[model samples]
Target: MTAPFIPVNTPLLDGNEADYLAECIRTGWISSEGPFIERFEQAMAATAGRRHGIAVTNGSVALDIAVHALGLDEGSEVIIPTFTIISCAAALVRAGLVPVGVDCDAATWNMTAEGVEAAITPRTRAIMLVHIYGLPVDLDPILALARKHDLKVIEDAAEMHGQTYRGAPCGGFGDVSTFSFYPNKHVTTGEGGMILTDDDALADRLQGYRNLCFQPQQRFVHEELGWNARMTNLQAALGVAQVERLPRTVEIKRRIGRLYDEHLAGLNRIRRPVARTGYADNIYWVYGVVLNDEVPFDAKEAMRRLGEKGIGTRPFFWCMHEQPVLRRMGLMRDESHPNAEYIARRGFYLPSGLALTDDEIARSAAALKEILA
Candidate 1:
């Protein structure tokens, strides 16, 4: 008989998640305003090496809040990876800032400093450095460029919870950084996110944005418009537990990557994700592989075949320039991001969730090799 299907990802909630959640329920502190909420925020900020952490309902809303907190004028340009999730661009657009798209590094699949430099213009007000997948972007040059250009750096470290650059943490470098506690991430809060920053004023603004911009002196009086994106105490309970287990989660991801490397070593029709020499080891956020030109099929076709064998996979993000929503808005009208387009068409990730077992990894790798062969 065939084995049960392995999923693309699954949340690991075996830690203190249940205990903390039960405490929240027993204490009747399940709402947005509760002890767990503050504890989670502080713990998350400390983990990311930031002074403050403002919890929000989800990753997309976290991005929106971070962008608005910058207070950039309408039409100010923010450089972003063309290969990132739509949340990056959408946040900037919603805040009345123009998003300048740049392609990723062919090897790392993360945005290059060269691309950021090439995309910069006088209207450029900031850089949204999205650390794609499990690896942190090459940030030294980007930080130097921002310093030279007086540009604000917003690090979207959603995919890089426990990942680092050099000796520093991913979220620690940005002027204001953000993280998602989505189920697939290293740490999960079910459906939650947090904005991290060292600046006192920016942290204040972030809190205001997440809480409907309530005036401190006058309760229910609003000084400016904001969203009700506050994360509940129940989510915070989960987050606190998840954050405590981040080190182990990262180890599991690396182990899965190594297993894939071992199992898929002889497959010549595909190229595996890169782990740069100087930076942190590629934690393999997902065990993605890119089909070489020698392969007769595209990623979609390869994925279909794998699915037939009961293996789950996910396609890479489509380039922002090719997105129909952005196209309709007249953005990236004539721009072509070759690398981003290539990766989007050719790359797909295997099951690399924290909960994945050795047996699942071996089975998934064998399935991929068979499908490609």
Candidate 2:
């Protein structure tokens, strides 16, 4: 007889999701114009301490909207941590803006304020601050530099939905901030994202950009081209229920992180996620494990062994500087990010999903320990 397989992520959606979807179906309000869309936007905005939320089809498009809303000059440079997903760079690249790469701290795995400061130049117009894994980038010095250098701040709080920085909400920090509701996130709407902001004029632009830039004054007139990146009433229906249960979900994530910490302790050759910092503890969006140099095998070989044990694993994000596409485009031609490279090659996340069971954790840990040992 074989044991059950453990997946990397299984979203916990035991909330009012069904009830809200039923409401949308019963009332025939299933389009983006439905009542649930507005309700979800308002709920997310209020939670993030922002005056407005513009829901989008997905998080990638949300960053697209955030970047374009700022209207940064073409050929302008925006600083970004090289450790983030390709979406962060894609947003800048699509807008004809340059993405200046900076390395993150080896410990927290978040970009350093010092790295970002060094990367700033006369062409610098904005900083795309991404909160990685579960810990946030140190914002005080970075925000201060943004103020002093007059650079726009676009916060990527996709994995930090219920997280805080020095008592302030993650989404509340940037001039324009964004969130993702992918199934893996603390809040899930199946597939969705939100752009949050306090500026009234910027809020209007965000909404317009999300909906093909339709002019209310003349419904068919278009001054500028924009994306049809509208989130469905169905996704928002789930979002309404999911957003309300954020606090409970956050605790669940923290609990999952704690369990992994206990299980993987004493594995000297492996580095665990930082449990806490002065400003915040890891929300443990996913439990990342970094193998030290002494480990006999790389992540690929370890994952192969884990797979044989019916354990699902995922490798960490490949550093942006090392991305072949960027290299071919004449970017990062003469640069190196050792810390980002070190983790990307050697790290992978265990099964840290919301629906993961205690027995599964024990089983997964045993399997990995056997491989590493």
Candidate 3:
């Protein structure tokens, strides 16, 4: 038996991270509104080709701010991929709007432009495009559709830090975008998030939402009822260090992804992920393999078997509209997202973090072959 453990995720921090955190503490501005925060926001904005980037507590809050900044009123609808983190749908719901879950494209596993068109109603106000598992969702068609329909486009780029779609960065393409800087993300700040936008007004509104809607002009003036969702200078310091190192991290991820593609091919039960043509860029946060529906095994069984081999893996996201909490909102009824359902049942992610040693990857791959063969 292979010895006892492979973690599903691990933080990719070691060099200079502790020093940076210490420097932030020495500076005594660890809470908020400090030099590191400004620096991080600016650096991220530049990376995304956006004029503004607002730091927030987490990706969920970033999504909430993005939704609120759009000015969508009650009963307004937001179209989102059903196969995504529940936070994407929950953000829209929290903003007093309706979430219309749409099916994903069979080939790319992202929102299909045709599906978006079919789901849009007169009440539709926006479309939130999620770049799942680091792959760029096909965006040109979706952007064109948004323009034609005059709908706002919000990008959930939490899984795609350096990914590009047709030469444009993932977070740079939408009207507004949100990013998660969780410990496992390509570049992390412990527990932080960012909002990137070309719209100055939206940026300002999001910043306001991050700080309890406190007026910039008056110290304690409240402009709107908002949550205290703020990222600290310590987190920003960590972010600055991580962002500076991201180019190398991205290259490492791509190299690993290609290796997985090459080595895992021809395995009977596994269907490798394919990067769509005309969309070459990706971050490879999680490398996925779809289990064949006819294989007589499901995700749960597959994961359990892998676990017994000391191999760690996780199932894909359950379709958000099918979740119990969202069901009470009446958002999922009369809706069936076949692709999302299929992936949820047959998909699981491998250990693809940048820090995974090559030997570990080979060992894991060997274990997968043993089980599948």
The alpha-carbon RMSD values of the candidates against the true structure, listed in the order shown, are 0.9, 0.8, 1.4
Candidate with maximal lDDT: 2
Superposed by TM-score, candidate 3 places the C-alpha of residue 146 at a distance from the truth, in angstroms, of 0.8
In candidate 2, stretches whose alpha carbon ends up further than 4 angstroms from where it belongs are none
Model 3: residues with Cα > 4 Å off, grouped in runs = 1-4
**Residue pairs whose backbone atoms clash in candidate 3:** none
Whole-model Cα lDDT per candidate?
0.90, 0.92, 0.85
Candidate 3 lDDT, tens digit per residue, 1-373?
5475877777677657788789888988898977899999998888888899999988988998888888888889999999999999889888889899899866567888889999999999899999888678888888999999999999999988777787777789878998999987987997999999998877778888888898868959886877798999999999988888888888888887788776787686777777555676556788887888667778888888888888889889999878988888677777899999999898998877777877767777887887777
Clashing pairs in 2: none
Taking the tens digit of each residue's C-alpha lDDT, what string does model 1 give over 244-333?
Answer: 998998888898899889988888889898855477789788888899999988999999998998888999998888889988998777
TM-score of each: 0.99, 0.99, 0.96
Candidate 1 vs candidate 3: the lDDT winner is 1
The model with the greater lDDT, 1 or 2, is 2
Q: Supply the global lDDT for candidate 2.
A: 0.92
